[model samples]
Target chain A: MANPAYVAVDWGTSSFRLWLIGKDDSILGESRSNEGMTTAAKTGFAEVLASHLAKVNAPENLPVIICGMAGAKQGWIEAGYIDVPASLSSILAGAVAVPGQRRDVRILPGLAQRDQARPDVMRGEETQLLGALGPGSTGSQAVCMPGTHSKWVHVADGRVTAFSSFMTGELFDAISKHTILSHAVAGADQSPADEAAFESAIKAAYEQPAMATNLFFTARSGQLLHGLTAAAAQAKISGTLIGLEIAGAMTNAGSGVSITLVAAGRLQGLYEAAFKALSLSHNTIDADTAVRGGLAAAAKAIWPN
Target chain B: MANPAYVAVDWGTSSFRLWLIGKDDSILGESRSNEGMTTAAKTGFAEVLASHLAKVNAPENLPVIICGMAGAKQGWIEAGYIDVPASLSSILAGAVAVPGQRRDVRILPGLAQRDQARPDVMRGEETQLLGALGPGSTGSQAVCMPGTHSKWVHVADGRVTAFSSFMTGELFDAISKHTILSHAVAGADQSPADEAAFESAIKAAYEQPAMATNLFFTARSGQLLHGLTAAAAQAKISGTLIGLEIAGAMTNAGSGVSITLVAAGRLQGLYEAAFKALSLSHNTIDADTAVRGGLAAAAKAIWPN
Candidate 1:
């Protein structure tokens, strides 16, 4: 096993992942848990970190760099925000130290778009953008980091000029569980996803973005009229949200700006399919890699090995 | 009070409203309760109807004409649907009777748009449409009936050409109660609604319907960045949904179709403000009056005096 030099953590609202890095910039050990900021707030952030560190057998003196909601006002410590238009590298300079820690623990700041009409914020995704695009990247790009609150950041000359956060993922969860559509999507998790239904919905919503909510109603109506499967119903919902998001995000970016989808697992496949359905050319980046790389950047910047 | 001719009930999923009509076509008595189809299903629809009838002091042998979810499959009787493109009078013709009742009890059938790509169904709003635009109307009109599932019906030459249902109200409720925006709108019901914030949101969403979900997030981000009040957050949510609905509904109608807003109370005010904000000319109709008018039309058709 390599000697640990620093720890990188992505502490989100409901998820926590940490990587112990060797001095050679290689991973020595890793730990993950559901003990994110929301849980750690009640159980003690220090205690949660200590347990994870022990699990990975990290050294006592090794410094730690964290990003995401842990730096939020309600999280471990408020690291604040870097307002756009901001250079990706500016995030490192705004990192706030968590006080009263034996091992130097720092949390990275989020990014905020202060436009009165379109006020938006992102905690973890700024780091993801930083990692995905790197510093001093050229050309205009629309970087999509899809999650509970999907973020579309417009980067021009390595500077985030503007961004919008769409409530696509969270809205899906709420609509599926709390609305009449719940009945339509019941038993969907047990069945295989209806890819055809998903793709169709993607095109429908993308072409008619104004009919997004109306499209959502089709999930139930589709079932009632056409005997649509639960999986198909769920697919329709997922597709409508993703398609509407793409439509909105694309509108925010300049004409012919390349899209870089930052996602992993299920979300990545869904978005890729959606992009393909709309005939929008795009590239993909693993979300986990991006976040970890972002954390690594912050770690190297802070530790200065 | 005038002699009770018939009972008119708008029995929905979560609400029940009753109006006793006189022989001279006037409302002789009225009754309302939270005992809609859901409650009536468990407590006995017959009993619930009987209770409301008793409260209204209806005659023992007075017949009943019911609309809304009471006619749904899960309601008192399966009144079924009158598939479109349908005539306004077709709904009254499709009414299904509840068997074994001493007096005639008929539940009006709903309207179903069976388009494979955009399948839709409306339980009670068809009656609202029938009343808002009488059976012998002229020209094209887009009738907006805002509620849990806002219905937009296209009426052409006294015929129901097409319609779409936007899950505006239900989405607003689910997003506010089950999502992160819940925190933003906490205590909003206790505060006076922020009219300015609502109007601004209406304009924003109307101009950029693709950014509907993004606008929803502004409720929280707006509060976090601009110190927006709970009332403002609530207003933003309401406005975004209504605005998105209007945009989608308008798109479904033909050019220069006059907008008839059939709504009452708070929803009516929100939508009127939304229309005014967008500078869209529209006429308002009392929803209660429309439903009753539709029911009266149905009664005359069923048991002509």
Candidate 2:
């Protein structure tokens, strides 16, 4: 086995992932847990990090590079933000060191668009963007990072020109679980996927984005009037939200920028299907790979051997 | 007090209001309670009705006319629906009587838009439409009834042509209480109103309804970047949802249709402000009066002197 060079951690609001990178730029060990910023804040960030490190059998002297909510004001330490329009490489220089530690531990700062009209902030996704496009990518691109808070970033010539965050996944959860539509989507997880319903919903919402909340109502009305299945109702909701997000993102992205989607598992499939339904061509990058690559870049920048 | 002729009840999902009417079309007594359909469903709808009826001093022979969720499948009894495009007078004739009630009790049927593409159902709003427009009214009208599930109805030549339900109020409740935006709007109810924030949100959302979810995020980002007050955050949410609703409603109503707003209290003020912001010419009708007028019309038709 190659000697471990350093440790990389992605500590989010509710999740934590660690990787031990070999000197040869290979993955030597890994650890994953639900002890994210929220949990660590209460359980003690240092204790959580030590336990995860122990599980990975990381060397006692190994330095650590961290990204995401661990750097948030409410996290282990306030790493602050890097204001846009900023170069992807500036992220490496903005890493804040955890004080009085046995070994050096750094947390990367998030990106913030402080424009009064469209103020926006992103933490872990900045790293994902860095890894996906690299620090010196050369073209105009609309990169979509879909999750609880989906981010649509417009990058021009290696700089993040603008970005917007849509509460798509969170809204979906709220609407489905907390609104009247909850009854319309109950037991959808056990049913067959409704591709036709989803495609039709995407088309409708894309065409008339203003009718989003109205479109959400169709989940219940469709069931009442047309005997729409629970699965179909769920598909309608997911499609409408995704379609509305795409429409909003496209308006900000302009006409000629190429689209890049960074997502994994279910969100990736859902977004890919939405883009296909809307007839929008796009490329995909695995989210896990992108974030890991981003952490690796930060580690290398901080500890060049 | 004049002798009671009949009882009229507006029973909704979470609220109940009852009025005792005299032979001369005067209100003799009134009662209000929070024991709406949901609570009544669990605690016994019949007992709830009796208690409210007793409070209003409704006589044993006085017939009761009811509307709203009390007529839903999950309410006191299923009053069913009158499919649209329907005539306003048809609702008056479709009241379903409680089979075993000692007093002559009837629940008005809701309107169902059974269009295969956009199926929708409304329980109590049809009565409000009837009262607001009457059975003999004329011309194109776009009636906006804002609430937890706001209803937008298009009536032409005294006929209900089309209608839609937007989950605006319910969404506001959910997003404020269950999403990340909750933190941005905590203690908003106790703070001063932010009319400027509200108007700006309305205009922005009216212009680009697709950006709603993104706009919702501004509550948090604005707070972080601009020190926006909790009240402003709340107002922004209200304006965005209402603006999206208005835009969608207008699309269904077409151009040059006169807008009639039937709402009471806070929602009325918010929607009126939105209309003013959008420069939409509209007339306001007190929602309480409209529903009472509707129930009275139903009572008069059912039991002539």
The TM-score of candidate 1 is 0.98
Fraction of native A-B contacts kept, per candidate: 0.85, 0.81
What does the lDDT read for residue A183 in candidate 2?
A: 96
B96-137 per-residue lDDT for model 1 (tens digits): 989999999999999999999999999999998888888888
Q: For model 2, which pairs clash?
A: none
DockQ of prediction 2: 0.87
Q: After superposition, how far is residue A77 of candidate 2 from its true place, in Å?
A: 1.0
lDDT string, candidate 2, A1-305, tens digits:
99999998999999999999999989999999999988999999999999999999999999999999999989999999999999999998999999989989999999999999899999999999999999989989999999999999999999999899999999999999999989999988822299998988888998899999999999998998889999999999999999999999998887667999999999999999988987789999999999988988888888998
Give the alpha carbon lDDT tens digit for every residue of B1-305 in model 2: 66778899999999999999888878899999999999999999899999988887678888999999999988999999999999999999999999888989999999999887788999999999899888888998999999988999999899998899999989999999999999999998922299999999999888899899999999999998889899999999988998899888888887688999999988888888899999999999999899999999999899977
Q: DockQ, in order, for the candidates?
A: 0.88, 0.87
Residues A137-244, model 1: lDDT tens digits: 899899999989999999999999999999988998999999999999998882228999999988888888889999999999999899999999999999999989
**Candidate 1 chain B worst ten-residue window by lDDT:** B186-195
Q: Model 1: which docking level applies?
A: high
